[model samples]
Target: MSGMHAATHRRSGDPQPVPPSAGRPNARTTVTRLLCVGAHVDPAFANAVVKECIGEVADTDRFVAPSYGYDVLPVLGHALIARNRRRYRRTAILISPFVPVLLSFLGMTATIIGIALWLWATWAAVFLERLITLHTLVAHLVVPAPEGGRHGFDGRIPDHAALTQIECDRINREQDGSSGLVYYSGYRPFVGAGTWQTSSAFPILLNRANDGILPPMDDRRSPGRAEVAPFTTAEIMGYIQRRLTAVLQAEEWEGQRIEELEIARRWYRTAIGRVRPVSPKDAPLPTEQGVEHYDAAREYLCVRVGSWDQEVVASVFVNLDVRGRTLYTETHRYELRPIKAAYHEVDRLPTAISPSDVRLVAAKAVVQMAGEAIGAAVTICTFPYHLLLRALSRNRPVSPRDQNEFGAEFPARRADVLDYGARRSVREIGQAPGAHHFFQDMDVKKYGDIVQKRVSELVIDFLEERNLDTGEYRARQATILNQGIIQTGSGRIVNTGRLAVGENASA
Candidate 1:
């Protein structure tokens, strides 16, 4: 979204911008519908999204968790919307004069008959049909319903926007406006399936002619030639931040486009061990404090480009350090891929109800009802085992807060007690095996190139303003910028001549 076609004429080296949402046939619709009905259809996926995306942290608190893409609220609340719509239909049908009531009665009878066939019939074919039906239903729900309802998955139908705002406010209040910092962990929230990709460093040495001939720049009175630049790291950082922000946060030319992409700058906090920001609130620190940390190499510039309603986020973290009169610019770009494929099953159901819709819904539900019956039978059979396990298990239901207050040995705040590598990323979980066409491979490359190039260019510009010789910087920039990713025989895309690779989940 940042690199629209109109901006292409601005610079020669700019990556041509393709429509961000292209190559996605009914993908957004399917995803939105799935989001709405996932709670009832696929409880596990719904729960994970709600916990990791909507809810800041998982119940078992260790690593920090935050959503990176797709407004989780609209999707999470889709179930509620669906439930309300169902309630309304039932109400209307019950109150109708005769025709609708009769139709509703017939539909209900047919559904009941379909369920009974699976639950009661002992024939192997019946059982098999039930199994297949349940499998299909578990994949997605596509119930036939009327159009233009109060709340629906149609793009025209508005979701619970006001309610979503209230819910978000409540969550913010609960967090007390401070996001947690996960210390001693290499895993990051929403970073898709790949190692963190880093660009070749661009060094700005005092004497570009002789690469490694300079003494330590830390000393005020070193034996060398010229004085330090008339700028501090903080000043240059602020300059870059402002310039980059102005460029990326373009005003929407298309008036109807809501939630235009915005650029935000935040301090990339770090410690001796691995550390990452769990929530946006945890990202920012006071400029003075941030500069202090940056001087000590404890912070980096986190330039984030959130597009498509934050469904896709490209974060380029730029770390700058001055060592021995050489200003080193190291950049790492992390991307959050589109939502999972399982959630895209909504397209199977069209907007309007048809004969096929009824058949599809009925067929899918038969096995699901049968599976419920089968599950009940299993629960009855495992009663004794469940009881034994419950009695033998030492783990009791106690909130961490309550346990700590009641004299628990380990403090709940102690994150280092038993560190687990990353449990799962909100974006990574339930993701499609490979990058979906919604976030096409081309789009990924374009976004990365534009963002990374802009960041590097800004850094070079900042150094140039300080009267630094950028001969080496320009040469390094050409090499690094030209090193676009290429696909290999295994279908994996890697940086040309570098180990850094894109988050190709299939690979």
Candidate 2:
């Protein structure tokens, strides 16, 4: 039979049971006894060890023992009275026969006080440290923007009392009795003096209603009041790392980079100037002498005009051998002229037109006169000079078919109808080569667009992936706590007779 059944039978007086072979306690009884013994022995051992350690008192120990031993008792009696004393006197020292006995009591008292103070200091330091370091680290890692940043609730007290019954019920269903308290202290404009606020109190209390003890709302000045829930270093570090990762994955930064690249590309395109062919030479000059005299002199001799009188026109020409190429061909002529002006009139012209004003003026007049005459001749001429210029400027290449039929078309001889026809045919076949293809044409926009789009998508994806709702909840808690602390500290609610009648009056 099972032990439980056997025990039940004996309890009901159904049969006389034999004694167990060994006198051993049950599991529950054994564990209970062991725990009791351990609890008693642990303190005994610790006390013995502490006594042994402080037995050898040095000079520094002598000073501290006397001062600390006396101060501890009075301070324990009344902290305000001890604080007023400030210094320990020899008369206040406690004396005893057994050195160990005296030292043990003193050491224990000192240790307790030191431990309490240290614990209080550590708790306060941790609160401030967490506030500063956590906020700083998260801000730097996340790089939150004016537009996008992590926001959350801060758990605190008065916030706990403000929750509605339904909201409390909902919180109980979600959180398994786990809650947090967050306190924030800062300057507030509405509050005459600085104050601290507590948030997340309502949710925390609701969660705690089912299980877990809610920590006491302690004064900032009290030792036991500053209790914080224990958390491992690894857990804190993990939280920081996660927050940082979320910030780095945002889309705004990626868009900014893409915008920068586009701006650079635009500036680059503007910096590159356009390309064009060099300008053409001016028109040719006309003959100055009578037409009959110039035409006859040109066939017989290589006649040339040195200069022309201002009132009379002069002419120049040259004859060339048919077999040998002439340096100055009759088809293409060159001429130079000089102008004479009165000495006093030179100042009326441009001050710095040229070093030699007379020669400069003459050359300028001759070129102007030649340009007018040539322009008139070309206008009246049957040659298609304008068409030739237009074709050259277009830079159209001659086609293979045109080359086979008409050899090559020359710009200077385009006046020949045959050449002009051949050139026109060549141009018609070739067509102007299409606009230059560039490296940027290979859908460069695709790369930048993809990067920017993916970055944006990833940012949205990341935000959706995390629990932003929780963060917002936490932020609300923080804000409520902050406001509550300010209201409480600012003395906004007055008690009867708290203020003078003349100072202020309200119904």
Candidate 3:
């Protein structure tokens, strides 16, 4: 019965033990006990060694625990080490009566070493916990929040009521810190139980030398209410139109198209007004120009319109010249006016406008102008507008799905249309070449395959210099991880062994 019990304990692939007749337990039990004890102790010893090594290398109190949760390996190692130590002590006592003195000494020595190592490991763990907590506290206090305490709204807007005087002062202070001015404003109508009021202020405007006073108002009152008259729609429109026209007339557009001219006008009307004027005699006239010339004209118009602003506005002129008698007995020539105003008015005054707000308005105006120009070019040139539309539509920064759906009607490429010098410059230097290079070298492959592969390598290098790259980020990550690793005494020994192994493998 004893032999059978021993046999049951034996693991597969182990040698058989002496029979009960030989005065020993069956091979199975002996093997089973050896394996169980070794399995438990070996791991515990390794962990203790690692912990001691780490403690010696870094202050345990400085180590920070991971925020996610506790790591299981260290905890498991601790439990196994204690179990194995207990088992080893009991087994040693049981075998002392039968074992040789030399073997017994070796066993005792191993147990002592194990206890010492475990003590060191425990000390290291405590030290690491303390270190981590200290570091975490320091980090928390030092590291600034990414949003700068402001949240929910777009970063361009400011946090204030009525663009108040105090807010303006704060904005000025911030701008002075950066050697520039930053304007912010918000406009919202107020509605109450039985009345409405429009309140607005321009913080920067109050300090400006050119800013004027609000329009006159009467203090007429109802039976139980106060009243005020706001700036009317006609006055606002007239002011905007006059300022915009003046700005446009002062700027120059060498070979701008009708659509571009329209965009500039719209931008002036919507945003801060800016305009310049050009004589018809100075405008580019048709001189038996090819399709390339026409395309060039279109491109020039697009750029001029898109780039217009209060500080930098442009005006375009076109002159028609005919050498021979006209086919229809008269030359057909008309200046195209593509953009028309559809105004809306509110009873309340608008809030102060910021520069960023103006930029957004200008961008929208430029887009509108481009659309109108393409439409007119197609009508006059008697060519397909789909291709131009698709290309320009793709240039916009929006989702791929939206772009694809919007450009679905156009072909992938079109032939027989020669780009003029102006168009060529716009494509090669203004937009396509730089944009194509950026996508080709980007770690994230967002652009289509055609653009990625076709972009020049030189351009890719330039783009990398201009923008952040993956390689630099990877190097930084490696440095941070190395700094994060903790090293104790036994861990150092293991690490040395690992280094040797790695070097040998590499060699």
Instruction: Report the number of the highest-lDDT candidate.
Output: 1
- Give the alpha-carbon lDDT of every model: 0.47, 0.24, 0.25
TM-scores of all predicted structures: 0.57, 0.11, 0.13
The predicted structure with the larger lDDT, 2 or 3, is 3
Candidate 3: residue 336 lDDT (0-100): 13
Worst 10 residues of 1 by lDDT: 1-10
Reference-based lDDT, residue 257, model 1 = 28
* CA deviation > 4 Å runs, candidate 3: 1-46, 49-70, 73-505
The per-residue C-alpha lDDT of model 2 at residue 192 equals 9
Please give, for residues 351-463, the per-residue lDDT of candidate 3 as tens digits.
33355644554555444434433343344454356668877887655445434644654333332222110000000110111112222223112111111122122222322
Candidate 3 lDDT: 0.25
RMSD of each: 12.9, 57.5, 39.9
> Number of backbone collisions per candidate, in order?
1, 20, 31
